[model samples]
Target: MKNVIFAGVGGQGVILASKILMEVAMNAGYDVKESEVHGMAQRGGSVDCNVRYGEKVYSPLIPREEADFIVSLEMLEVLRKLDYLAPAGKLIVNREKVDPAPVQTGAMKYPSDIEEWVGKNVKNAVFVDTEAILKELGTRKALNIVMLGILSKDLEFTGEQWEAAIRSLVKEKFLDMNLKAFTMGREYKETA
Candidate 1:
């Protein structure tokens, strides 16, 4: 089974990203299972979605340290979901920091060396400034699509398959921009 965990703050579009992945997996003829936790999402709380796909996926929830991939949309959320990564898991994380309630309230601290920590812990991790890319595109809502494009690199699905998934799920008005964002993300060189 391929287990993927998508983590980020409530508004970061992690849920949507997970949905796109699920659809793509299903389209590829994999038995897919998915679960989501979004308590207090509107208040900027933690949100995550677990997706499993294979010939026969039995569980929606990924066990500890069993995730094949963790696509994180925020810096601190990457830390929160680090333990879910398998020994050889790959991480695609956004290089953006969103302070949690405790940290914003001065009751807790956000780690200063998060990039270093992730580099030290994960065997294969790619960090992207997705926010900056989206901003340049004039639409931050496409961050999820951008992340999806990055993930498409590691999957067997074709660009047409991904575009079909996006076209089916996204609204008509925003389709062009989202498609643009996805292409930009797919072409990203990790150094870009």
Candidate 2:
């Protein structure tokens, strides 16, 4: 089974990304299961989704240390969900940081050593600059799709399947931009 966790703050399209992955897996004939938690999403609180797909998936919740992939839309979220990653799991993290309420209110500080910690702990970690990619694409709304694009490179799904999933879930008005973002993400190569 392939277990994936999509995590980020509210308004980051965490749910949409998971949905797209679910669509792709379903189209590929894998039985899929998903679970989501939306905590104060409207106020920019944490949001996460669990997606599992394979020949037969019986549960939606991924146990600790069992996820094959942890796709985090924000750097801080990666630290929050790091425990869920399998020993050999790949971590795809956006190089963007969204301050949580505590930090925003000066009640707490966002961890400054996340990158160092991730580097020391994760065997396979990919950091994507979503902000820069979205800027080049001329839109900031397709960050989720862009992250999915990075993830698409390593998954078993075909390019066509991913496009089809995006076409089906994304509205017509935003479809072109999202498609471009996805392509950019798939072709993205980290410079450092």
Candidate 3:
């Protein structure tokens, strides 16, 4: 089974991404199980989604060290969840920093070179600008869809399946725009 962990601050759609993946896996006839933790989510706290898929998943929890794929919507949160990633896991980062604490408090302790830091830790890491893509797509809310698209290439899923899942969860009027974001994310290039 492939184990995945989606981590990001609240409002980044990490939970939605996990749910979409779960529905797609179910549609594909895979046995899938998931778990989530959302402490302080309303204050923009961290959110984690543990998802697994295979012929028969026996446990809903992925071991703290066996995540096969880690999708991070925030750069530092990527570091926070790095320990859970398997040795061969792939890390997909949003390449954007969202924490306002440093600037607000004048602490100046944030990592200025996030890509370099990720390279040092993750075996495989891909960084992309999902925020810009969503904005260009005329919707700031589709960042999760954008990230999910990029993840699909590495996971056992595709844009079509994700589209179906989104349609099932959201209002019909917003489906087309979300689909567009998913397509863009799925087509993101992997850096050498």
Q: lDDT at 75 for candidate 1?
A: 85
Q: After superposition, how far is residue 19 of candidate 3 from its true place, in Å?
A: 0.7
lDDT of predicted model 1: 0.86
Runs in model 3 deviating more than 4 A are 100-103
Candidate 1 residue pairs that clash: none
Model 1 agreement with the true structure over 89-117: per-residue lDDT tens digits: 99998898888878889999989998887
Best by lDDT: 2
Whole-model lDDT per candidate: 0.86, 0.89, 0.83
Candidate 2: where is the Cα deviation over 4 Å? 39-42
lDDT of 2 by residue, 1-192 (tens): 999999988888888899999999999999999998754654678888999999998889999999999999999999889889998999999989888878999999989988888888787897777778887888777898899999898899888999999999999999999899989999888643
RMSD of each: 1.6, 1.4, 1.8
- The top-ranked prediction according to TM-score is 2
lDDT of 3 by residue, 67-140 (tens): 99999888888878888888888898888788656655878777788798677766688888776687779977
How many Å off is the CA of 29 in candidate 3?
A: 1.2
